[model samples]
Target: MSVSSRPDGRRNHPLSRPVDVLERRVRIGIVTVAVLGVPLAGAAAGGAAYEHDRAVAEAQRDQWRRTAAVVVSEVTPGMSRGDLAGDGKAGTAQVRWTAPDGRPATGVAPVPPDADPGDRTHIWVDRQGRVATAPLNDTGVWAGSLAVGVLGAATAAVAGVAAVAGVHCLCEHRRDRAWEREWDAVEPEWSRRPHQGG
Candidate 1:
């Protein structure tokens, strides 16, 4: 009687094939994690930048408020002043005016670019009956925008990394499964085939 040649040439246990496939999948997952590391770092950096910009705006707003008080204390009832000018940073505003006491007074405040001229002007009479001018500074809106931009960029970067990693892992898993199934198909033939006597 003739003996059929084993399809696989070597016998392999059915359970071992599946185990090998699972091991390869675990390796793919590890690689995915490594690939995503760079984006995660970018997300952290973006978050930090957002926080720093927010803190700076807040500090600037507080300083603007103090300057406004000085302006209000220097304005006189009949004193004429030109439109306030911002130093282009932290919404700093400078107003020129003459006090009711006939003294020239200059006050700096924080004012938004769109602030109404009337609202930006404050007249306060000191004990000496001298007028003062107070201007308004609006920095909250700009500060908030800075924070939002930074955070949004960070979120997008992190999400992109996760998506790429997920796709890579899925592809690896599919490939590994196909290889395992091909090996399994030939495995049973090896076990069932007859062995020739030596």
Candidate 2:
């Protein structure tokens, strides 16, 4: 008889389908592990980096508090205020000052004893004269920026992992279905076929 006319058709058996299902499960598991692992590792690393950055910033701010003083030269209308770093070469303090008229001014003055830059930084004056430096208020902005950056990165990483997992699940489901079909085609022939005449 022709192969098609045989009692056993090409239809697979359900029992044999498990192999394909198992293979798909293994593949999906592997992909899921990889997808989830990478982001978790990145998040851990980001946390560490954030901590390191915070520590460093705190240390720097503390040092600035000890060595520098805040002095408000004068306030001006429409004047933009900002923070100014020490010139590094001069003992003179550099600060951004705003005039009552709202005008911007840069002031440089000799460091004063008993002056703390961390407190009331709006006011900066030296025995020589008052100087203007940028406003110290921007520290909060900088800190916020750092936090936002870390959080954003972490969110992106988690989203990416989720997407990968979703794709893996979809592919596994399709594979499982295909495997079932394959097995269904093979199963019926088994019982009718001559199995060593047993």
- Best TM-score goes to which candidate? 2
* lDDT of each candidate versus the true structure: 0.49, 0.49
Give model 1's clash tally: 11
Worst 10 residues of 1 by lDDT: 76-85
Which parts of model 2 have CA positions greater than 4 angstroms off? Answer: 1-136, 193-198
1-198: candidate 1 lDDT, tens digit per residue: 444343767444454445454555565665566457545555565556556656765554443332122333222322133222234432334454555556666655444444443444443334443332233234443444555655665666566566656665776687788777776776667888654332
CA lDDT, candidate 1, residue 76:
30
Give me the candidate number with maximum lDDT: 2
